[model samples]
Target: MTTSPALDGPLTTALVGTRRFFTRSQVSDDKRSIHTEGGRSGDAFYRDRWSHDKVVRSTHGVNCTGSCSWKVYVKDGIITWEAQQTDYPSTGADRPEYEPRGCPRGAAFSWYTYSPTRVRYPYVRGVLLEMFREAKAALGGDPVLAWASIVQDPDKARRYKSARGKGGLVRSSWDEVVEIIAAAHVYTVKRWGPDRIAGFSPIPAMSPVSYASGARFLELVGAPMLSFYDWYADLPNASPQMFGDQTDVPESGDWWDAGYLIMWGSNVPMTRTPDAHWMTEARYRGQKVVAVSPDYAENVKFADEWVAAAPGTDGALAMAMGHVILKEFFVDSQVDFFTQYNQQYTDLPFLVALEDAGDVADTAEGADGPAYRPGKYLVAGDLDIAQAASENAMWKPAVLDARTGDVAIPNGSIGFRYGDEGWGKWNLDLEDIDPVLTLHGLDAGGTASETARVVMPRFDAYDGKVAHVMRGVPVRRIGGRLVTTVLDLMLAQYGVARPGMPGTWPADYEDPSTPATPAWQEEITNVPAEQVVRLAREWAQNAIDTGGRGMILMGAGTNHWFHSDQIYRAMLVLTTITGC
Candidate 1:
């Protein structure tokens, strides 16, 4: 290529000495102009930023659940600022529109990236480095040998451990970090079991690739990747307890479809900053919001009513609410909402082996499954529930066969799907088949529970009864041990008083006038009986009117309880009845 007149000029003079833009084809300019405020033109201001040369698109790898994509502005290999990326592909017309997502804390994340406390390089405690070096010197510089020497001697290892907080960290090179880590793994795995040498990292949901890399390495080496859910108190055990599975929530956008919203415990705006606007927008769409919290939290402002029960008592409130809805709205109403939904979906229709588990005084203990194990829901098979389910998905829960006075295995449960065809293994429908929901003929039919072991297994029996007599599904018994429905068991489990009910086993605990009454719930939970009744009635009515369009949003505050299953079951009871 021929040289331009600009490049033909003396190189030094054209490049840096007042004359700018010394390219082969472009002219130079000082770019001086009083074109705007501060007597500076846009060109001059833009050109003055000498180091702003490149931008990289990336995201903060913080362990937050909602890690938004970011565009990182870089200059001289250092990040300057980051903004949310707005070009994600459209999911579909069926979903809500997307927006640039980020929280205030995440938006200010750059402060941490460039902070003084940020990690500059791999480091080991000063004392540990010196110990490793000395061991290396003595052990012929073999990394594995050096690590073994330090570890085999507990005193030497403890000496380095003691220096962790006291000794300043010594800068480490990449090679040294990798070598030391490899050697330590080799030594630990040799000395202890493979599972003993575990890998622990932060939430993988934020940055899956990083987690996968470490997990893959450990998995390849036969080392266990430690679970973080329970350790970090983040696992929602309630989901598994109620649904027999976990993680089945709809997207946040689904809130727009809900007509009644119960914002219980979760502060959506505070915790879900990116999606919080959707909730506010949902409110604009005429969704009624109820906030359940001990304090008047920020979200309370958006709520139509605030049920401020004391902390740690949210479970009681949920149970009380369930009681009111079950009795007043479900049982009393002609819709038969609770019973119909129970048959279609829930384990409420399944027979519960009501062979007197034991005298468990406390519902809290019952919830935890220590004081009383609510008898297993009975499954239909020639074999007992155990032997039948002994094979993969072999145990099938039986619904009462209203005809033939026998138990019929339904088409949708795990067992039936496995036994039937190969497709749709998890399908949950009762469409072509009608299964008996009540144990009314359990004994008379003589087709089921002819063997005592199927009706009442003695391995788990306790001294006293945990349910009232009416709670039992009035099935023929095996030598006097009666069968019951899970719905009945749940009623008794929640301290519902069944007073004046004749032959209600566990007579010591029943008060017919007290069970499920608003007064009882109000006493258990500090929430007023009148308010509880009102909310329950409204909740049921709204769901029924809208065909189950109500939504309940709960998070850590409710699910963190040790006996969280009770709260979950209560919510499940409500949701199931309304088909929500």
Candidate 2:
């Protein structure tokens, strides 16, 4: 076919066939050869040129809240097709293998590069732009004077505010945008503290360089940076309760290694498309999975069991499971494997000294009532302990010694390491040390007159089965008072009632009214009581069979709670108990 006449070139209708033109059919000016020496179709060559002219390595850095390297095929500097890059250097054999990561949000991003809605230049309200230009002229081209005139006058600022959301944004030059922005910042800072001029964007995980640029500038200007993770409530703040950590979870490849897997509110198939293959393959390898969530979550499709727990009741179910494991495995059988695990890794045996809160009816004017999270801890101040600091010796934890009357600091406890060398390490070893016994004891007589009970942090399913409030725990205590273990307090807070303990002291686990028993959990969670108890045992047994190979992959649905820390603590309880 003859090449079409060019619209912009110096060609007119009059010269359509008058000259021997340089068209696709004829390239020579002499017109001796109308076609190329080879008569083969020329469309293939041009198609190849347009399809694969050049390719540059780049990535889809758009809506994913992140980016991944992609091989972008380009023709004449225009992007055509892109695919996941495979050349990233693998780190190690153990870590999860990653693909050039992307989400469905990326598919539309290439189109958005040149979309009509793309913000190609700085923008301001049309009225504001005109007003600013008028101000500049009126102020004799002095930008600072123009800015002050526009912003200082209430009418000038109000005019733009009234036009907002009215689709009147005008393209603004970079200089004008920067000038106005700087003036606004100056005005804000002069009137208010730098902290008031806070900047917020997504946290660095999605785009570190972009985030860092804003952060660095804010830091220089003494302006506060609002943490996006905290503001958006994405942080797993419960991580620190055990030993501060995140995202160090095993890779998808490691899923095949699991004997039992729990997907706790993590929508793996949807959110983790790259890792979904591993999950499917893991099922093929015969690894069992338990999906725990409220709304029949996406990952439940892969699970052997789907425990549809009620909303916000995961903690209650978890606590009930903990009760089963602790009661069946630890208390009933005293399984050496689990007992040793607790003795080493957990704060299970840490001591909590009991303080009696006089009946709530007898509340005095200034006296503080019952407190679950104690501020201070009980210490043997008279024992002249060498490890205890002279100023704040009470903060040291007192573990039971083999000696009848003496207490010692367990080798791995926060108390033993506090104000000492190598204090930061979270090693689980309790060698050459004794854990405080989990039995009730009474300090009958002491200079500090009030009788104190040695308290363990077991949950009392019954709110007040006995006259004493077993559910109440002191968060902190001052010197010359009682102390408690973190585990003991946490358990009590969860209401894991231990039967056959003392005079009706613990709740009857079979009773649904008891807060953390499977029956009670069933009421709140809507998960059957049998499922909770069975899953707890099955999970524990699986961990034991596989040498602590059970895992739970969780995400933001549970992390965004006001009581997220409690949820994390409950998970910590189950994982620590199962040695997972």
Candidate 3:
């Protein structure tokens, strides 16, 4: 037979021959090329893979919580740099403003990423080898390198079985490492209970899910809570006393609505940002700003007046100012309103008189004496009855001395006692009378009079004369003094004989013979005498003023001090007395 021309040489030879020689040759050639390419391509792929792996691996050591973006750098098939990705969020061609990508510590991300001290592999020593041998023998297996054994019998034995079980060192595979960690967590939870398993983190940056889980777990386990500020002493001490709750201050809204602002011991600008902003706004709005502090602060700069008084002496300053305000007629029109509506000012005179007469027990009487006990009111001596009263007449009985039944006699008593060698005996008989009548209750004209008055003929009077004390005097002090002197002069000059008016004085007066001793003054504050007196006078004037408001703004700088609570309380007193 004749073979086809197309297949004559190779096909005919292949049909006649036993083996397919041309097919074998083609296969061989293809195999050779593939083998050659595999070596080169494999190396290149592995190199790239290893470089990418290193970059990812380095990220494990970074203490970041995704709050910032980052960049990675690789060189010679290894990660070399990692840094805050300031250029991230780039708008392709158009660059946006560079925003900081990390916290202060994140700036050093590169240093940690490229640290030479980082361990790349599990290390094993002779002791580890011995432990591996022992484990293999115990498991009825031929002794093998620990790392290899872990990979071979992952399901049968722990990758770190030797180290974990017997506290022996052993090399482990990645899978084994993960398994070991999981098992440990499970074992701990099972063995020690959730209480002992507080949390697991090498850093403070916790994921939200993790934090929630941990927090819930801790609450369930009855774990002791970690406090935010362990260094605050006043919070610990005053919280329970003031709020009856374990917190420093209640979440009260802005106090800027006050017609008068009094800042006692608070420096708004240095410490508090929001309040400082409000104070600035208040000043811009022409709201009267009063600062009562020992230190001249940024708040003082905005103050209409500043009272640099002795620290801790604020209570005295406040009481004195109240006295002055009552004596003067400045706020006389509002006295009844305050007595009936505001618990703080309602029975202040009576309370002070009680204190003066030693009528207040060690426990002291409430604002509405004979009704509530001391400490029942939020303020020291303030009672709800005082606030709930319909008129000053309703609260007048509480102000009188119940023991001797002696009350203040209004116009019947002169300003000063005269011709009284044996006056003590006669006064004793008068003290025995009913206090309502003796002290002078509501009379024909619906006015109350001083039972027995002691007038100061040399009293300083400033009527219709607008005198501006330095901005350094506290508004409360100024208000108090102005309220007392101005009101008194106005009443005396205008002949308005109203009971709770400017001309009326508090029944209780400070004994000039018993001024604060030097030792007592030094114990309370570090202010000079002259400054203390001046501030006291100004605060007094402010307290009684009719056409003013008092406002107080506390800032962080003032609050962060060791004596912040005391300072704040003092300021509160100053403001309260000034009717701010």
- Model 2 earns a TM-score of 0.70
- The lDDT for every candidate, in the order shown, is 0.62, 0.63, 0.39
lDDT of 1: 0.62
Clashes of each: 13, 16, 56
Report the lDDT tens digits of candidate 2 across residue range 408-466: 65554444455545365335556666564343332333112221222223233347433
Residues 274-379, model 3: lDDT tens digits: 2355565655655567776777777788888767766445544443443334334233334433332223222233222111212222232111222111111111
Q: Considering every candidate listed, which one attains the maximal lDDT?
A: 2
Question: Which scores greater on lDDT, model 1 or model 3?
Answer: 1
Per-prediction TM-score: 0.69, 0.70, 0.33
- In model 1, where do residues sit more than 4 Å from their true spots? 1-61, 67-96, 109-112, 123-184, 231-234, 332-334, 356-373, 383-393, 403-405, 419-426, 432-474, 477-482, 497-530, 558-570
At residue 500, candidate 3 shows an lDDT of 38
After superposition, the stretches of candidate 2 with alpha carbons farther than 4 Å from their true spots are 1-69, 87-109, 112-184, 247-250, 353-373, 377-383, 389-398, 402-405, 410-428, 440-469, 472-480, 499-510
Compare candidates 1 and 2 on lDDT and give the better one.
2
